[model samples]
Target: MAKTLDELLTVTAPVDLPSYDSRATTGFDGKKADAEKQLTQLGEELSNLQEKLFAGGRSGASPTRVLVVLQGMDTSGKGGIIRHVAGLVDPQGLAITSFKKPTPEELEHDFLWRVESRLPQPGEIGVFDRSHYEDVLIGRVRQLATPAEIERRYGAINDFEKAFTDSGGILVKCFLHITKDDQKERLAARLDDPTKHWKFNPGDLDERMLWDDYQRAYALALERCSTDHAPWHLVPSGRKWYRNWAVATLLLEQLRALDLSWPQADYDVEAEKTRLAGM
Candidate 1:
């Protein structure tokens, strides 16, 4: 029998990224149709959880928050995950950020500074489309920073994450795992359609050439940064349907673990109802 998602995922340290199957779909034994049905149900549950979580925080019922960090190579369906999973939540309760090449102002600050400023507020779900992991992944691959600087960043990232989690934040980092072949197909599909041409960047081909280096960088980052406070989940993204389902499942699992409750008003409800009824 195939393994469960928890077994298939890489949440613990000592991870061997190369050994992880990008094509993994070991848990669910369903076709696209079945996965879609499950995704619909999961979406409904997630919507409810998001509202309650948001309400709890907004009403001072809870201080808990959530942050989802998504990192992957180009054409890895990060956009799709946003539209499918995070899109299910109420806009008021959702916070989304897409990290890109740093600006002059951003470069002046510590790498994590910008990210820290955008964390989810209490009872909110914050999604980082491409998070600080870029510093280690692309920074290492493209030699944007010195080797010593890169090494220092690993420690800095761990400390930042520890502090964040200590503050009632549930951090879930997911690395969308897709094969080189999958990327090629995705890129090709985009090219074959004029509407998607906007998504294509010539520089992506340049980065594709350095795929091996990026892979190594990711492997090192995952191994070094995976901690009990916040762990990494290597989500197989070869199949779009399965990828969406797995990521959605992960989000639902984390939200359920919070055990959040609807906040109750302190005033007497019966008396308030009677008074309002008289008016």
Candidate 2:
């Protein structure tokens, strides 16, 4: 029997970040070209299911929605997944949010208040480039929040996610796994090319200085937050094509699990056809 992608990539055991290979294409034996072909093949199916989901939401027939939370170190290809994987579906059905630094208003409330506002509505597939986990990841590393406060956030985040899932949301949490060497090379490439200069941030290097701290933060987050309701998947992201294909495949699995069908016409179809012909 073939293993499911979820079974292959989902983080079931406690992770030791340093030991995991960043370039591994686990469960996929294909080359880059093959992965790209598979990603393209996923398009029609993704689009069709997305249309059904959108229709269900428009007609208020279903509350099912999907949320793809992407968290990774810089240059781990979060934007690439959104552009490739989420792009396979209709743009109308996707609500993509790239969480940035908190605005003054956002700072006034509890950390989750801003996140709650950005969740995907019925029938939509929501993608978060960087998400609430930032509060725990960067927040912990930078000591932006008190140590005790950071500890409290783990339970808070778990409760918050449980509530979202209870309300008919499907959460696909992914942590794009990459290595320090990967970041160094990518950043160097960015600096080497003037056109790519905009992508580079000196502050990113500042964060890189504390790479060990960030790793500890991430390991803790993954272990503490990988609950039954919303387990995180560790996606090896050094290979961009494999990362894109893997995420697309994971999404396809979730959409298929919904078992959605084209919504039935609420009005009489034959009568409508007859009326249209007469007109």
Candidate 3:
């Protein structure tokens, strides 16, 4: 029997970041054209499941929801996943939040306060471009917070995720893994094309200089926060097409596990039909 994608990609134990090949498409052998074709095939089932999920939530028939938390270094294609994968479902069914530097008001509250506010509603699929993990990732790397404070966040995150799962929410936490060489090439492309200049940032180079530090940060975050309820999947994102396909497949598997059905009519359907005929 074939292994499931979740089984293939999920971080079951502590990972040695240096050992893993970011460019290698782990567990998948199909070419780019094949991946794209598979993605198109995934669309109908994904759309149907999303519709059922949305309808169930809209009518207060189900409390189930999904939150896809995407975390990675710059140039990791978080936006691309949102555009290609989430685009397979209805736009109305998705709640995407692209986290940036905290605003003054956000800074005043606990880190999770803003994150909790932006969670997907019952039946919606929430996608976080960058998420609460930043507090630990950049927070540790940049020494933005006290050591003790950063230490406290790991347990806090586990508890928060536990509560979410206990409340019928499914969390899909993905770490988009890419190689340093892969990133350098991508950044170079951004600089080479005038049309892509808008995507280029000088500060990205500064971040690139701290690549080893960021990898350590990510490794720790993945090891600590990948819980039983919300395990993190390390996606090899060196190939854009495979990344899109894999994320979509992961989501499809989650939605299928829900076994959603069209909500039953709340009123007398036969009577409504007669009434409509009379009208």
In terms of lDDT, the best-performing candidate is 2
Tell me the whole-model lDDT of each prediction, alpha carbons only.
0.89, 0.92, 0.91
Error of 2 at 4 (Å): 1.0
Model 1 vs truth, CA RMSD: 1.9
RMSD of each: 1.9, 1.0, 1.0
Candidate 2: stretches off by over 4 Å: none
Tens digits of per-residue lDDT, candidate 2, 1-279, equal 998888788786577998889899998987999988888888888888899999998788899899999999999999889888888888989999999999999999999999999999999999999999999999999999999999999999999999999998999999999999999999999999999999999999999999999999999999999999999999999989988988888888988999997777899999999999998
List, residue by residue over 77-141, the lDDT tens digit for candidate 1: 89999999898789899999998899999999999989989999999999999998899989998
lDDT of predicted model 3 = 0.91
Better of 1 and 2 by lDDT: 2
TM-score of 2: 0.97
**Model 1: lowest-lDDT 10 consecutive positions:** 2-11
Q: Which residue pairs clash within candidate 1?
A: none
CA shift at 17, candidate 2, in angstroms? 0.5
